[model samples]
Target chain A: MMSARICDKIATAIAWLAAIVILGVLASFLLYMLYKGLPVLSWHFITGMPSDIRAGGGVGPELFNSFYILVLSMLFSFPVALGAGIYLAEYAGTGRVTELIRLSTESLATVPSIVLGLFGMIVFINYLGLGISILSGALTLTLLNIPVLVRVTEESFRAVPSYYREASLALGATKWQTIWRVVLPNALPGLITGITLTAGRAMGETAILIFTAGTTVSRQAGDFDLFAAGETLAVHLWYVMGIGLVPDRMEIANGIGALLIITILIFNLAFTIPGRMLQKRMTGTRQ
Target chain B: MSATIIDHHRLKLMYDRYVRYLLFACAFLMTFIILSIVIFVGQQGLVTFTEVSPGDFFFNAKWDPSEGQFGAMSFIAGSLLATLLAVGFGAPLGLTGAVFMAKIAPPWLREIMRPATDLYVAIPSVVYGFIGLTIMVPFIRNYLHGNTGFGLLATSIILAVMILPTIISISEDAIRAVPGSLEEASLALGATRWQTVRRVLLPAAMPGILTAIVLAMARAVGETMAVQMVIGNTPQLAKSLFMPTSTLTSEIVIEMGNTPFGSAWGNSLFLMALVLLLISLLMIVAIRRLGRGSVV
Candidate 1:
């Protein structure tokens, strides 16, 4: 009994030590990056065209490419994902079909973004002749985003109480009406959070874009051309680190690195604050 | 008036059915997308095996594409080693942190830590890669006595951190999911809180914790940019952690741009995807059956 007691105390101490160290590590990593990254940010870094000249490249095109690609992906994926979410949450399923959807989505989720890129290259670039275009990358991204979007939207919609649906239906509303009006209104925050998260992912994604969207920094008038190759901010940062032939590769990395971190941080907070609040409120109200 | 009411009700029911089926079709369409991806990867991946024997593809020492050698033994080993190393660090830290978050932390700390973990999840892999590239790589080279500073060890550390949020978030939920009644029963028998947690809560939560570990492993193995940026992108196997090696993801990235269309090299990369996909598919099924009620 004495030995067991001693073992418990020691285990607890170790757990506490591990917990504190993990937390400290996470904190220091973020703080260190912010410290290292902040000094490199400037207006020119955000808007100036990247230069081929040594030590003079800017991230202006990369940032634009990131947003453009995100928009393109979201444009196509959002509707289908939201539709799937609605079906899962609002409709009582026939079991097998719903099971298949759940199974397929989960499977799709595991198909790595890198593989998705390779697949996109094969199908879109080779077969469809889209080349290394924004459209191809966007299509690949849509696949990556679908699983997460469906899960998020489903969860958010499902969190709305049964009573809300019941009341709406009893008031002479149809099932579709009740879902679209009563359920969707409540799930808007969740939808927003899912979209924001997906957007953040699209911006940060590098591997998928590597093959689907080529890495050339175009100075041509094809900035809006979906057929043109678009290298994203994450990919650009990666390029700078890997094969970027600039004298100031480190400086460019530092600058873009800060913006990428800040952009993601903003997206996270933007969704997470409301997402958490909505989650707490729903669970709280349920209890 | 009653006839009109009947007509209105019928119309509403029709609309409901139409909408429901439409949404179900959308869900069905998602299934189509998954199928197409598998088929696409399958069709392309199969091209490599036409000329290269399965034995040669798996066992050959060299992976030079220009020279037409496409064996992926080292890259496969590299990915496994990377995942193994990351899971080693991530699992312990994550499990302990989850325990602290769920049962030990004060409410105030929980509030802060919860959001911080969310932020961690949202941070880009490239940023991690960048930090690893500029900082960790050099640090290892200077202090850790590496030739070029990039290696398996640095990649593992980044991956460990990257997978940490997944493990902690899911495991914390699992711990919290353990019935409070179990803890109360242990306490009633005069066990300390630590004993209750260790003996009761953890056992009850074991399935969920396993699920978390599996998911984290999947994520770590699939991770690309961060691992690539710092892992030295060497095709051959390294003898030690302080040396450079390639992963499947990194190999695809490094070689794909230079690889021409319809080449044996290009198709072999797809075969790598096929392998990665099949493994994850197996894990996905495991998770679905085990984690039916859990959030991914």
Candidate 2:
């Protein structure tokens, strides 16, 4: 009996140790990124333009392109994903069409980002003749983001209470009216969280953008044309490290990494905060 | 007045049917998009595959894109090697962590740990790539060579770290689903916690663990930027983990622009994507099997 107790104690200790070590590794990576990346971060770095080899450069263009691609992709994907999610959760029967939708969505989620990149190249760059433009990149990201948004939106809508829907109907509201006024409002937090997470993913994506968004760093500050070739923050960091860009250019890459991390951190916070608040509210009401 | 009321009811019925059709059309559009892409990739890629011998494409030592000698053997080997190494390291660690959270940890600790795991999920892939490029790659280089920057070892470690959350989250869910009564019975029989977990809980949760591992494998294979930044981007097969290598995803990214519409290089990109699609399909099938097996 004593031996069994000792063994139990040993296993418990080891389990705790393992969990702490894994968490430590994650924390250390975040700390190290901030440590190495913060020294180069500044307002000048944020807003400045690319400069000579010796002097430091800014990531203004890359920043602009990242936001532009993110906004464009979100604008394209959000409504379509939401519409599909509503169809699956609210309207569709469990038949051949619904089964096909489920299977495709699952497959789409598992399909590699690189495959999406290849598809974008074939269709947008070749067939459509967009030629590595920002518009093409946005379209590629739209495809990539849709599956995730659809799944999340469907789940959130499904979570709404059946009683609420019945009550809205009893009040003489139309089906569409109940969905918009009662169901959507109740599910708004989850929907926002999903969109923010998807947008963050689209912003930081590199490989698909690498193909659809060409590699050239536009030195011309005033040129904001969507059709012109451009770089994003992630790609710039890659080029800097891989090709030994000028000293200032390297600094610019570091600054961009820091900024990207910050943006991701914010999105993560947005994802968790609403869920946490909802949990707390439920507990408080129960008390 | 009676005729007008009947007409209003008929219009309402027509509108309801129209809405249902619109919803079905939206669903159909998604399926069509996915099917068309897969068919297009297979058609273009098969043409290129015919030009090269299957053995050469799968087992060749070099990939010379410039010379029009396209062989994906090295990239395939590198991707598999890195994924295996990552799974070897990550699976045990993640399973143990999940066990701790699901069975051993106090409620407070579990709450804190759960959010932390979710945070790991939210961290973007590019940030992971950046971290790998800046910190992990240099650390590997310094210890392994003191001069060279990045290689397969670095890529594997980064992938392992990036995949930990997926493994832990899924495995924890699986472990939690195991019946508590079994553990209680084991304890009453004077079995050690270690024995109970190893014998009762883990075996019962094996299918879940397998599902988690399969998902992790899918993610590891599909990973691009983090591995790309740290894998040195070489196209040849190497025996050493410290040596440089390329992956299909990175190759597609690198060669996309230069390859013209009808060129073999472009077709090869499609072929690489076809390979990825096949792997993911295999993963889905495996997960489905595991899910069914668990229920039985």
Predicted model with the maximum TM-score: 1
Number of the top DockQ candidate: 1
lDDT of 2 at B153: 82
TM-score of model 1 relative to the true fold? 0.95
Error of 2 at B183 (Å): 4.6
Per-residue lDDT tens digits for candidate 1, residues A12-74, read 788788777777876776777778778877887778788665676678877888888899888
| CAPRI tier for the interface of model 1 | medium
In the range B203-277, model 1's lDDT, one tens digit per residue, is: 888888888888888888888899898999888888999888999888878887887767788889888888888
Q: After superposition, how far is residue A208 of candidate 1 from its true place, in Å?
A: 1.0
RMSD of each: 2.2, 3.3
- Model 1 misplaced regions, further than 4 Å: A1-9, A92-94, A220-222, A274-287, B1-5, B289-295
Model 2: DockQ score: 0.50
Error of 1 at A109 (Å): 1.0
How many angstroms is residue A69 displaced in model 2 relative to the true structure, after the best TM-score fit? 1.4
Second chain TM-score for model 1:
0.96
